[model samples]
Target: MTEPQHILVLGGGEDQLPAYHEARRLGYRVIGVDRRPDALGAAASDLFLCMTTRAPDRIAAMVGHLDVAAVISPASDAAQESVAELSRLLGTPYQPAPDAVRASVDKGWFHTVLDRLGLPGYAYAQSSDEAELRRAAADLPLPVIVKPSDSSGSKGVQVVADPAALPGALAEARRHSFTGEVIVEEMLLGRHLSAEAFLRGSTLATIAVTERSTTGAPHMITTAHTVPAELTPSTEIRLRSMIMDICGELGHTDGPVNFDFVVDAADEIRFIEMGARLGGNGMPLLVRHAFGINTYEAALRLALGQPTELTPRHHRKTALRILTADTDGVLLGVDGTDAVRALPETVELQLFAEPGSRVHRYTQAGHKLGYLLLVADTHDALRAAQARAESLLRFRIEPATPRAASAAAPRSEELTEQIR
Candidate 1:
């Protein structure tokens, strides 16, 4: 009797559960990796490895003996390179170019590729030295964004509207930079949108344009995403064209790719960034619920060098709202969750924080306590359902002590001086 092929999946978080579930459904023996032993996907995996997914060499060395047929890192930017590396070492057909994977995560290199392709891009400067960063920020106009060249989920990202605040922002960016590099660019003012697509050669087989909402300025964490983003037919065409151009130029013309861009009042699109894998924050799940096509399964099939079916089974209105707390405190309870789940429009309700755990204000995507997915027959109904869900769901947090608050306040103010 023939044995089932082994499929290695990086990340075992809530967002990565779909890949693990789909892989199991496809009859592959799943091996899951994550630093957290209690990761949500661990229960779903056939074999779970407790380790960071960022180090490809360590993982490759550890699992090299297995007859791994394919490897995938769903919804994780940090694990894309590792996935590519393992695929190459294991001679899996899903090997994406290592350079392309690096470019997908590096802010400066991504913009450089866009410029080389004559694609729409913003004026940006990158450097590792603090003096150089200040000079770069000076050249740009007021209200610029400073961020680490290699970090995602808005970590160490800051908007500096004043010259006096440049140093502090630079320090934060540098602190988060895995490569100690920072990019300073003008803050493009416009409607933020995210595009999720699967590419076959140069063609976008399945695509979704989503209206992205973020907590405005400074920390700028994503708050919500509404699928089938309202766009003019012409604008949507241009956006699709741009996606092909960017992915094609980077030599990443296959598998899943998601992009972040801003469409200005003049209807001009400025590229922010792109990830060469399934998007994090339950994007694949949302897409599945809204379009009736599962990109997670498609990605797995693609990894195994098999043909995929990405045609939309149905088109429906859907949205995802990130759940977060309002202040730093101990989680006491979550109220009305049962009522919210009973709503007809509620597709899924996931809570990440348990009672007695620590929760913080929503400063970045990482700070989110959970997310709510909703779907309805019409856009208006979807919006109404979302409003209703928000009203019914509540996070109860016990306020932090005065001493603890005092101790945490100086961490930001003192970081600049210490980093200097």
Candidate 2:
């Protein structure tokens, strides 16, 4: 029998499970590496290595001798960096340069590239010191948005409407940053749209523009995302053009690329952040459920140097809304999960916290405890399903003291078990 080829998948978290399973579907043995022993993706893989994907050198020590075919990370920055490093060592088809990934992770770099491309410009500053960050916020136009320079999943993001709020906001942003650096920029106001783009060596195969909602000011936590975002034909064409230009400039030679952009009231499109991998919060599942296509499988096929198809068989709609904790408390019970799951339009309903888990305020995407994922055949049907979700999903909380709050430990806000 021929030896089964091995594919190294970094980040053994729930969001990365699809990549592991997809690689297997393509006849490759999946090897996973993550910092946690109980990572959800590990169960889906043929072998699991308990190691941090952030340290590529360490991961290389374990899989260095393995005859790996390729490396891929679905929803993590650290893991993507490791994939680049491992790909270079293995001589496999992967983004071997850290700079390719930095085009998305480093906001300062992203802005510089945007200026080079003659796109919309936002004045920004970067620094690690809280004093410098506050000064940058003050120096930039008032109502600046401050966020970690190299973090994802809307983690450590804060919009300061007043100068007085800049200091605290800077602290929160710093908490989620691995490099202890933050980007302070002038706020871009308007509808934020999530860009779902799949590419293979600079070839844009498929793209989806989704309408996104977020909690305004203080902390910019995403509230909901709806696929098939209604846009004028001209606007959609322009969006696609811009996304193609971005992927080319970013040197996306292969695999999946995800981005979050905003269309200001002026109808100008500006991408704020991006990732060189599949997105979190069940975005791949949304694409599959909404369009009868699996981007996860597409990404795997690209990694293995196989021909892939991304044509949408049908137009389907997807809507995902997050339910967050208003205050610090213990989760008592989530009522009507069964009823919501029973709904014909309900694609997935996940409650992250158990009956007694301590839940914290929703400052970032990781702080969200549950989400209602729905899919419908039509826009009206999507709205109806959304309404049913809103009414049927209720969170019962064991309220905590007004002054008391759950102490948050430092964690990678991306690819956590709380994610899909």
The TM-score, computed over Cα atoms with residue i paired to residue i, of candidate 1 is 0.92
- After superposition, candidate 1 runs with Cα above 4 Å error: 1-4, 403-420
lDDT of 2 at 285: 74
lDDT by residue (1-420, candidate 2, tens digit) is: 766789998887657877888888888899988777867766788889877888777777777777788888887865666677788777786444465688756887888888888988888998887777766677787788888898887788877887877778788888888889899999888898887778765777777788987777767677888999988888899888877777778777666778888888878888788788888766787788678789988877777667777988877788987777775667767777788899999988766667887877777676777667788888799889888777777666655764333434323321122222
Q: Who wins the lDDT comparison?
A: 1
Span of ten consecutive residues with least summed lDDT in model 2: 411-420
Tens digit of lDDT per residue, candidate 1, span 67-97? 7888998777878878887887789978886
> lDDT of each model, Cα atoms only?
0.84, 0.77
Q: Candidate 1 — which pairs collide?
A: none
User: Where is model 1 poorest over a 10-residue stretch in terms of lDDT?
Assistant: 411-420
lDDT of 2: 0.77
